[model samples]
Target: MKVEYKKASLGDIQVMQELVDPEVESGVILERSSDEMATNIRSYILAYVDGKLAGFCALHIHTASLAEIRSLIVDETHRGNKIGANLIYKCVDEAKTLGLQKLLSLTYRQSFFENLGFVEIQKESLPEHKIWADCIKCKHFPICNEVSLIKNL
Candidate 1:
């Protein structure tokens, strides 16, 4: 199971949408329309196994010094193979390349993220500019179950 991580293009949106649909329906991940994904295509990184899409993660720049790691999902069949960790490594590498100081995520998998060296932080500790813009659109806004985690790049 050779896994490759690559920058996503408009052509990948449909597949990515399909990959995330179930999680969205289950309310575990937020719903993102294809149009919204296409509009933000540059922020996405996709993982493929043997030329088939396996999972995806996105690094969305929130400010010069900060970025958010979002939409990280591994196909159900591919869980526990370290695909998720590889995706996070790609995002963290990108963050370092961009000279960003931190990478953050709002995730339900707190222990998993902790294993990757991310530390839990109070949501309010995050930059208001980052939260106010995107977190506001989250279904759990104002009372999100997702915990905030950050890794210094």
Candidate 2:
């Protein structure tokens, strides 16, 4: 099946919300309001298959040399079709275009990221700015089990 990828727009917020809420509820990702997604819409990339929203991902830049792939979620119905990997490739290409030196992600799906060429790293090794800006606000901060994975762009 062919998948189309594009930047997330305001019109796609409702679908993105539907696709993301479950993960947030289950604690796979931090909670975000629909308004927040709408506001940060430029940071997102969406995947579509047969005109249906398949997944959403965000390339969140924190500094000159660092960026994180955030909120990457592929719908259950579309998981095995490589939609998630395509989303990551888009993020990586965007990161390269933006002159970013690295990409990082805090994810529970280590094998998924590992398959995409991301290497496991110490979460604390990341700059304090990234930790302060997002992780500190996360409900599972101190107890978070997500692995920090990185790929030098």
Candidate 3:
């Protein structure tokens, strides 16, 4: 199967929502509002398999030294195809191009991120900006079970 990667555009938001909402409902990803998706649409990378949107991931820059890999999701029908990894690689490339020094992932799939060379870290080790700006808004905040991981670029 051939997978194509591209930067997300405003027109992709509806499909992005359709692809992400299931994961959010299952408590696997954070909920994203339409406004949020429209505003940060450019930060997202989309993966297409056979010309259909199959998955997505985003690189959210928090500071010159840091960015978070967020909202990674692959369609259930497309799991195990490494489309998710390709999405992540795209995010990593974007982060590097922006001259960011590190990539962060707050994830439930610890082994997955670890397999990609992200090392486990204490949540406290995350920048305050990340905690205040996003984490605090997460429905699972203060009791979130997601593991924090980092990869130096």
Candidate 4:
């Protein structure tokens, strides 16, 4: 399958919901509202295979030197196709473009991130306290099950 990566626009909001809702239902990812997706649409990069919605990921800057990889998901049927890895690399490319020194991922899939050159780290090692803003909306909060990893760009 030929997967094309593109920046998401506001019109892609419904597709974003369709892609993320399943992960949320499975308790693998935090739920996102269409409104929130629309508002942050530019932060997202989408993957399309044969012109169909394959998956997406986002890059969110928290500071001059740091950014987070957010909302990474590929269709269940598309698993093992490397779409997620491509999306993450896309974020890393963006991070490098913006002169970010580090990219962080809070993920349950540690080996996946580790295989992509990320190293495990205590979440507290991150300097920004504002990164916790998203925690307020997450059921996991202080007890987040996700592992924190950083890739130096």
Candidate number with greatest TM-score: 3
Clashes of 1: 0
lDDT of 3 by residue, 35-136 (tens): 999999889999998999999999988888899999999999999998888888888888888999999999999999998989999988888877887877
The backbone clash count of each candidate, in order, is 0, 0, 0, 0
Please give, for residues 65-153, the per-residue lDDT of candidate 4 as tens digits. 98999989999889899999999998998899999999999899999999999999997786666445677677666677889999998
Which scores better on lDDT, 3 or 4?
A: 3
Reference-based TM-score of each model: 0.94, 0.94, 0.95, 0.94
**Quality of model 2 by C-alpha lDDT:** 0.90
- lDDT of candidates 1 onward, in order: 0.90, 0.90, 0.90, 0.87
Model 1, residue 134: what's the lDDT?
73
Which tens-of-lDDT digit does each residue in 55-134 have in candidate 2?
98999888889899999999999988888999999999999999999999999999999999999999779888777877
Enumerate residue pairs that collide in model 4. none
**Alpha carbon lDDT of residue 30, candidate 3?**
86
Residue lDDT tens for model 1, 63-150 = 8998999899999999999999999998999899999999999899999999999999998898877778777877777788999999
**Cand. 2 TM to true fold:** 0.94
Give residue 11's error in model 4 in angstroms: 0.7
